[model samples]
Target: MTIEQAIDSVKKGCKAKFDSTVELHINTNLDVSKPEQTIRVSVVLPKGTGKKVRVGVFASKNVETAAANLSESDIAKISKGELDPKKEFDVIIAEPRFMPKLAAAARVLGPAGLMPSPKSGTVTEDVEKAVEQVKKGKIEIRTEPNAPLIHTVIGKRSFSTADLAANFGEVMAAINQAKPSKAKPDWIKSVYISTTMSPSALVDIPDLA
Candidate 1:
């Protein structure tokens, strides 16, 4: 769907009330064929979604030192497979050549789908930007268990429906244009959207179609 359609869909399908905080979940085709390719995007809501996400970076000290990328934060550290990957973080980052290192954490991260992958743009020179995105409401998604889950905050309970809809549309476009390819059956199996401490409501992916 184009950006316009995304905006329209969110406006029509939104069910949250005026005094309710909520989020949006989108499922669509994305472009991720090239590791170096930049994912062009814009935040409809200038203030942007507010969600605290953790990032897990796995790299050799040499590799970690080679680049003056992002400063390592508590959330952006090593997460080898031996430990509980899910508990470690939400997103995973690693050197493109060292995907094998992720094998150990596969069992843990795979199920939760936090496995670091070059195809997903986790192997990037702009490590700082990658981490910063997570600091925003950017979500970590995978194609194994489900088609593609794009979770992002819409707004607080105080936001107007139109404001929330615009934010939702931008997130939809981001998810749709994230990877270059579409899922075999479709990019979405199901969708559930909600806020930080609220319950999610089922949203039909067809809204975007």
Candidate 2:
């Protein structure tokens, strides 16, 4: 199916009262067995993800003060554990010095995909910048460690076709830029788009190229 068709299908099939997310599932030919083939990157969607992102920052005096000045509520949520990685915070940013503190919560944050990592642009000294980017719709894309599939939310089902299409194009461009040098021509095997609860619609891979 074409990109337009996929977006139309996803929007029409969405039945949720709240704005449901639209996701892109990509299957690549890269071998997951090779550590070098693992793909982890970030991209800012042209249209935001259509969800309010609650960001958490782990930092020392300077960074913490900067973060608190930006959003005191977010800092409180993190310190109070009210922003449970699994349920509250959408993304977590950490300064290098605070990496040790994160070790204590690794068991909880790791599995929820909320753990801050260098590859995901979440582990950095610039805690304030990272939080700002996330609030502005920066999203991380990573291939599953055990599989060649990469899944990420592109936008909301309520977005206009043009907006969704623009976001889709940006994601595809980022993926292409991240292509492994050792990967073959058919690196991207297939692409599919779907709403949070709807069946997926296939997107023409050739068109993406």
Candidate maximizing lDDT: 2
Computed on alpha carbons, the lDDT of every model, listed in order, comes to 0.51, 0.81
Total clashes for model 2: 0
Taking all chains together, the TM-score of candidate 2 against the true structure is 0.86
Positional deviation of residue 153's Cα in model 1 after best superposition, in angstroms: 4.9
lDDT of 1 at 137: 51
lDDT of 1 by residue, 134-162 (tens): 55555433332333335556666455556
CA RMSD per model (angstroms): 8.1, 3.9
Off by over 4 Å in 2: 61-83
lDDT for predicted candidate 2 compared with the true structure: 0.81
Give the poorly placed runs of model 1, Cα more than 4 Å off.
1-21, 25-47, 60-82, 141-163, 175-209
Q: lDDT of model 2 at residue 147?
A: 95
Per-residue lDDT over 162-202 for candidate 2, one digit per residue giving the tens place of the 0 to 100 score: 99999999999999999888899899999999988888999
The residue pairs that clash in candidate 2, if any, are none
Clashes by residue pair, model 1: 30-179, 30-180, 31-178, 31-179, 31-180, 32-179, 32-180, 81-104, 81-105
